[model samples]
Target: MAAFDELDPLSGRKVLVENNLTFHDVTEAVAAPIEIPNARWWGFFIVSVMMLGLLLVSLGWLFWEGVGIWGLNNPVDWGWAIVNFVFWVGIGHAGTLISAVLFLFRQKWRTSINRAAEAMTIFAVICALLFPTVHTGRPWFIYWPLPIPNQMGMWPNFRSPLLWDVFAVSTYFTVSLLFWYVGLIPDLATMRDRAKTTTRKIAYGIFSLGWRGSTRHWQHYEKAYLILAGLATPLVLSVHTIVSFDFAVSQLPGWHTTIFPPYFVAGAIFSGFGMVLTLLVPLRSWFKLENLVTIKHLENMAKIILVTGTMVGYAYGMEFFIAWYSGNPYEQFAFANRAFGDYWWAYWIMISCNVISPQLFWFKAIRRSPLLLFIISIFVNIGMWFERFVITVTSLHHDFLPSSWDYYSPTFWDMTTLIGSFGLFFTLFCLFVRFLPTIAMAEVKSVMPQADPHFGEDGHHE
Candidate 1:
């Protein structure tokens, strides 16, 4: 072995010994020209158009008539709208967490997934914001939820959970969108350079904001990014915590639990990872991004899903144990009713989808297989929806009074709105895919072995 002084600092080639074998770092892995199956992009485009049309139609209907056209009523007034709101907000968490938290941890592997994940974060937050405002019944007076001057001398209820949600969600969206657009600047410059038409070049050039890859610019850029990521890390945690408070702060038997804050955070990550997997697994293959985003990245993501799913399962177990131990009859009965009551099917579906489905990832074969991961991701999504349903409707349907007890199922309008939300999500995503870089070229380049001269042989110096 060469002594430290004898070795070149410029070529600090350190061998990675894994599984009793040595490996050398090579040139940066350049993403090959993507030759994705034509059908995939076309299919996504078609589906997005259809969904966009549906979303416009639904929004028009909701705007024209009012919230009353839906099934919301007294006692059950916080119906599917709030559930969908929380669900979409939860879905938003994983993106920022992956981008900010993982970046702080110096997880170099995050390069492939972080770009698209951040975009999803922005779009998911947009989907989430629609609910509470529209659910207000008087959609025009949605500003009443904000801290603003009004005709009345009254201030909005500062103590209200919904009020906290308004602040938290808005703050979260602002920060997330900022972080995402900041990251996109370099990539947008790349698109601007590669543009073939005057329109495309001008559009991308403006968005790129005259980025020139200057060392000084990068110095400030990196500093700004670090500060933004630091801000986002805490905000990501707080956003979902406040969302959970919308339920936990309530006196409802099933909703009232101390574990909800962290439990909601974990579930948010779980479901958000599920959505990421659903989008990426298809996208990587469809876009022929195999060299850019390899199987190792997918496997790592699967591992996270497995870990979060287990935590979710443990939370479920704790809720049951605590309900019984608290000696509160209402709490115990609520949990018991969840497992084996009229809506027991929804409860079991939640358990099976969230808990059982993720277990398949323990098998390396399943985790590595894109198709299998895609299927599991869908199951996780379904399970998460039911998890919200089990928490909201199950708790609200049969409350403290037996006389007020009633079964709740979504009406046609409710289903239409739900479907339209999917359309909205996909519509935004499709637009992003067509226009945006999709991959973080600058970030990916930074992580490449070639970027670090110490890792390659040719850069050797004494």
Candidate 2:
């Protein structure tokens, strides 16, 4: 075999595998957390559980008190709940973008981070799903949106974008889950074989689905994975596009723009990457996975954030331009009020966080610093939340009629419920980190230079 040594053209860094890690090393590194539990992990898990409990309490109170507990009223009918929904949904877009979109483009860098990002996508969707369900007020009757037969003879309005959301989000979640699980089979088998205890072996074996890693098995696995990736690539765009439709289909001035689809999709990916960085930075540091999840990977993600951030900024500008160009007074007033009205602070916050902060990534130094990347990512998350808030609340607060305009604010329950959603997200994430391989071991190994047959042990090209 020939051993080829090359440099990474982008970073001018050596492509040699650091520490000469092997396939066994990759498996052991990923499986270590499952085998040995740590105090930090438990501490984080406990906190997440406590937060989840808070969500449960808040939800229970909301059910008992009704939707009146929130800051919803005449003009501002949809409040923090819808805002949170859109925010979480947008945050889910990055996972499929990295996993399916990049994979289709033959991007190798995704191997190290795709597993956790896909898990984050599923968790984010779960949080997003909570908002619409709870907002129904009588959440138990949420099945009303389904086409289930009923004695009362009530069928869901298929034309409504709200119903469209039910289909879009559910389909996105199912496809993402299947893709993630399919990728885990080989790694799960590795875990099963390495397990010392019968309980662990049995559990992993069941999840592994009798994976033997034979040549025939791999051929089928590759085909299935590729097919799923093809299916998921469109979902990365379509899911968010349909979500934007929930607003665009409305008669509201600010909500009715055609730009909402592409704009929302970009913002979703932007926020999704930010969240991925927020979760991964601390995770890699805590687990000492810097070698695997290197600065290069973080930098690449930062570049994406910068590009998408710019697109979001452009979309923001175009909305204002369109408002004026349309010669529609309601649209003009809505856009003006969004930037200079009662919720002006929120608009600027969204601008600063989503548009301005990511510009720092243009500097290689900033992108290379984990602490800076983490901080900027947090800003992106906060900014994206405010973006939804500004869109949902500001548009509703000021309608065409001056008499109906009213200020809206979240109630105590609203604040708690939002916090609780974070708890639910983290709780699931912590559990995932503990039980499953946080990194795709097989994929990571495949990208390693040692896996290349053309690379010889003598460190020379064939």
Candidate 3:
């Protein structure tokens, strides 16, 4: 087992994983929270439920009163609901990137963070779905966007970007859920085997599908996982690309741009990683998982934030440059209005938080500091939200006609609903962290030399 000590190939330093951890240690550490609930877990859980209740209350009032309760008006019909929709959808991308794209590239570091990231992806999508459902003001009619047959004889407009979003998001969520659950089966089986009580054993056994850890079962699991990863990699790109289409395909001056697909995808990854860091920083310490989710892992994620943040900043500049270069008066005015109009503050907030703050990661000290990284990640989240706000509100507020130009502000219901969405996200995340393996224990073990048959007893390659 000593021969299994992970080493950084570049600097030859010991890697982030603890050298002495065994397979049993991984199982016990991951399963402990499930078998035993602590005060801290319950404390967070209760808070999340309260927030979720707020969401329910807000929605109930929204349904009872109507969409008129929102601050939406003639020019700005989108308001905060669309802004939040885009924000939450963008935040889901990082998990798919980590779980699928990185897996296809054979990046071993993903093992430490992929489980939580995938779970975040699923939860974020759930939150994202909520806004559009409620935005329709008739949650019961939500299925109208789907291609199902109806008595009205009107099928969904296949050419509509909104319809594209319906298909894209649903497909992404389904694939992500399957990918996440498939990965969990082996770990669930491990829990089932280790369960002390019959109820626990039976519950886990059902979800585990009676996994026996046989060589053939592993072969099938690996094949299915690889296939899903292959399928999901394209989805990681397509889901957000289609999402950007909701804006880019429109005739709207600020949104209709060739650069949106790549730009939105980059911003999605940036925000997603920010959220991953924000959640994991506290989680690592809370669960005493510092040894597994090492500073190197944190550093790697920060580096990603730096790179994507730069890309997003460049996109910001490019949008302005193109607006000016195109010589289209509407586009030019739209970009200028964003920078110097009524919502100018929001534009600057987006720039400062998304572009400037992420630059701090260039410092090795900051990248390695969990506290600073966590703080910066929160800033990135705020900035990304503001970015959506600036794009959605600023563009629509001052379109072509001055008569249609109107100021947009979220009502109390809007504010509460948005906050409630966070509650929904955190509730799901808390449940995931509590019951499931926060880390991919099987994958982590597979990366260790101790799991390799070819390694010699003398701590040398055979």
Q: How do the residues 1-462 of candidate 1 rate in per-residue lDDT, one tens digit apiece?
A: 112212223434321111121111111122222212255666877887787677678778878888777776555767889888988999999899889999999887787789889888888889889888777767888888777877787799999887999999999999999899999898788778777779878998999999999999999999999999899999999998999999999999999898999999999999999999999998877665665566667778999999999999999999999999999999999999989987999999999999999999999888878889999999999999989989998898888889888787777778777777887888888877766767787887676554565655673632
Each model's lDDT comes to 0.82, 0.91, 0.90
lDDT for predicted candidate 1 compared with the true structure = 0.82
My TM-score estimates for the predictions, one after another, are 0.91, 0.96, 0.96
Ranking by lDDT: 2, 3, 1
What lDDT does model 2 reach? 0.91
Candidate 3: global Cα-lDDT? 0.90
Best by TM-score: 3
Error of 1 at 311 (Å): 0.5
Taking the candidates one at a time, how many backbone clashes does each contain? 0, 5, 0
Give candidate 2 regions above 4 Å deviation.
1-17, 457-462
TM-score, cand. 2 vs. native: 0.96
Candidate 2 lDDT, 1-462, residue by residue in tens: 112334644345544234667788777777886788799999999999999999999999999989998889899999999899999988889999999999999888899899999999999999999999999989889899889999998899999998999999999999999999999999899889989999989999999999998989899899998899999988878899999999999999999989999999999999999999999999988887766787778889999999999999999999999999999888899999999999999999999999999999999889888999999999999999999999999999988788998999888999999999999999999999998889998888987776767665464533
